[model samples]
Target: AQTVTQSQPEMSVQEAETVTLSCTYDTSESDYYLFWYKQPPSRQMILVIRQEAYKQQNATENRFSVNFQKAAKSFSLKISDSQLGDAAMYFCAYRGFYGGSQGNLIFGKGTKLSVKP
Candidate 1:
């Protein structure tokens, strides 16, 4: 069984600053994918970034990057140069590369982010 955990229920950041959102997971499988998804008030799950378990380098997408600690099972998201549009509910998810339900994503409870001017 796999589970994702987002300890912070909510976080706030200034419009031009940077913020890091914490996330951790427990899993027995060796091959999998870790993702950070953002859902704005509209409730659409958008993939922010993803990291493969076997990849040593963390995944990055423009201003969005991940700090993937494989040995400790920690995957945190870093939002650089935060903007008002980045305010949303962020979820950390996991999907095994091989399993009975390979494509099913196990999601965290989510951390709501608010941007302050």
Candidate 2:
């Protein structure tokens, strides 16, 4: 069984500042993918970043980056220079590259991030 957990239900970050959202997962499989997804009030699930389990380097996209600790089963997202547009519900997710549930994504409850100016 694989599961993702977001310890924080909500987070706040001041404009132009940085914020980190914590996520941890339990997975017995070694070949998998970890992702951070953002869903705004508009209800769109945007892919913030992704990391392959076999990769040693953390994944990054623009203002978003991840601190991936494979051995610890921890994957955290760091948002730099926060903006109002960054306010949204962020979800930590996982998917096995090969397995019965390979086509499905297991997601966390989500962390609502509020950006304050």
Candidate 3:
């Protein structure tokens, strides 16, 4: 079984600053995918970014990017130019690509991010 680990229970960043949330996982599968999901107060899960194990280059989307270290089994999310809207709970999720067509997400404990206005 794959397990996601979040070392930080909470994080905070000043508006316009950058913050990185740490995540690590254990998976015996050679192929898999990683995701950073953000859940705001509304409780809707939004995909922040995703990284495929085969992709050597880390994945990035606008203000969000991931530092994926396959050898170390570490995947962290970096939020740059943070904004008040970025305040939410961020979860690192793992899904096996070798599994069924529809894979289920195994989430970390989540890191609560606070953006100081």
Candidate 4:
């Protein structure tokens, strides 16, 4: 069984500043994928970034990057140059990549991020 956990229920970041959201997961499978998705007020799940369990390097997308520690089963998101539009409900998700997998995404409860000007 795999589960994602976001210890912080909410986070705040000043405009133009940076914030890091923590996420951890427990999975016995060696091959899998981790992702960060942002759902804004409009209720759209936007893909922030993703990391392959086999990849040693962390994944980055523009101002959003992830610190992926495979051995520790930790994947955290760092948002740089935070803007008002960055405010949203961020979720940490996990997916099994092996064969016969259901391809279901296990998501965390989510961390609500608010940007302050």
Candidate 5:
């Protein structure tokens, strides 16, 4: 069984600053994918970033990036130059590359991020 954990239940970031959200996971599978999904007030889960277990390079998207430490099973998201629109509930997720639930995303409880002006 695989599980994702977000230690910080809530976070607040001032506008124009950077915020890093912590995440860790436990899994026996060697080949898998980690993801950071953002759900705003509208409740739409948007893909923030993704990292493949085999890839040494961390994944990045615009102001969003991930620090994926495969050996320690840590995957954290860093949001740079945070904005009010970036305020949302961020979830860390996992999916095995090949398995019965290959495409099914197993998510963490989530960390709610509040942006302050």
Candidate 6:
């Protein structure tokens, strides 16, 4: 079974500062997908970014990127130029490319982010 673990329960970053959330996974499959989703108070899951297993280059959005270490089985999200809008519950998820039964994004418990003014 593939599992993801997020050690930090919560984190806070000052406005305009950067924060890196830690994540690690245990998966046997060499090719898979990793994702970071954000959920605000409304509880809507939003994709922050994703990295395909074959890609050595980490994925980066406007203000988000990931540090993916395939050998170590670790993937972490880094948020830059943080804003109050970035404050939310961040989830690290793993997806098995072709799981016959279900297509699910297995999620870590999550790390709540707070942006302080």
Model 5 deviation from native, Cα RMSD in Å: 0.9
Single out the weakest 10-residue window by summed lDDT for candidate 3. 96-105
lDDT of 3 by residue, 1-117 (tens): 789999999999999999999999999887899999999999999998999998999999998999999999999999999999999999999999865732788999999999999
Per-residue error for 42 in candidate 6, Å, reads 1.4
Q: Estimate each model's TM-score.
A: 0.97, 0.97, 0.96, 0.96, 0.97, 0.96
For model 1, the run of ten residues with the poorest summed lDDT: 96-105
Instruction: Please report how far candidate 5 places residue 101 from its true position, in Å.
Output: 2.5
Candidate 1, residues 10-113, lDDT tens digits: the string is 99999999999999999988889999999999989898999999999999999999999999999999999999999999999999988678668999999999
Clashes of 6: 0
What RMSD, rounded to one decimal, does every model reach?
0.9, 0.8, 1.4, 1.0, 0.9, 1.0
TM-score (C-alpha) between model 4 and the true structure: 0.96
Question: Residue 34 in model 4: shift from native, Å?
Answer: 0.4
Task: Compose the digit string of candidate 2's lDDT tens values, residues 6-115.
Answer: 99999999999999999999998888999999999999999999999999998889999999999999999999999999999999999998867564899999999999
After superposing candidate 5 on the true structure, give the runs of residues whose Cα lies further than 4 Å from its correct spot.
none
Give every collision pair in model 6: none
List the candidate 1 regions with Cα displacement exceeding 4 Å.
none
Residue clash pairs of candidate 2: none
Residues 1-117, candidate 5: write the lDDT tens digits. 789999999999999999999999999889999999999999999988999999999999999999999999999999999999999999999999886876689999999999999
Better by lDDT, candidate 3 or 1: 1
lDDT tens readout by residue for model 6, 1-117: 889999999999999999999999998888999999999999899999999989999999999999999999999999999999999999999998887742588999999999999
Each model's lDDT comes to: 0.95, 0.95, 0.94, 0.95, 0.95, 0.94
- For model 6, where is the 10-residue window of minimal lDDT? 96-105
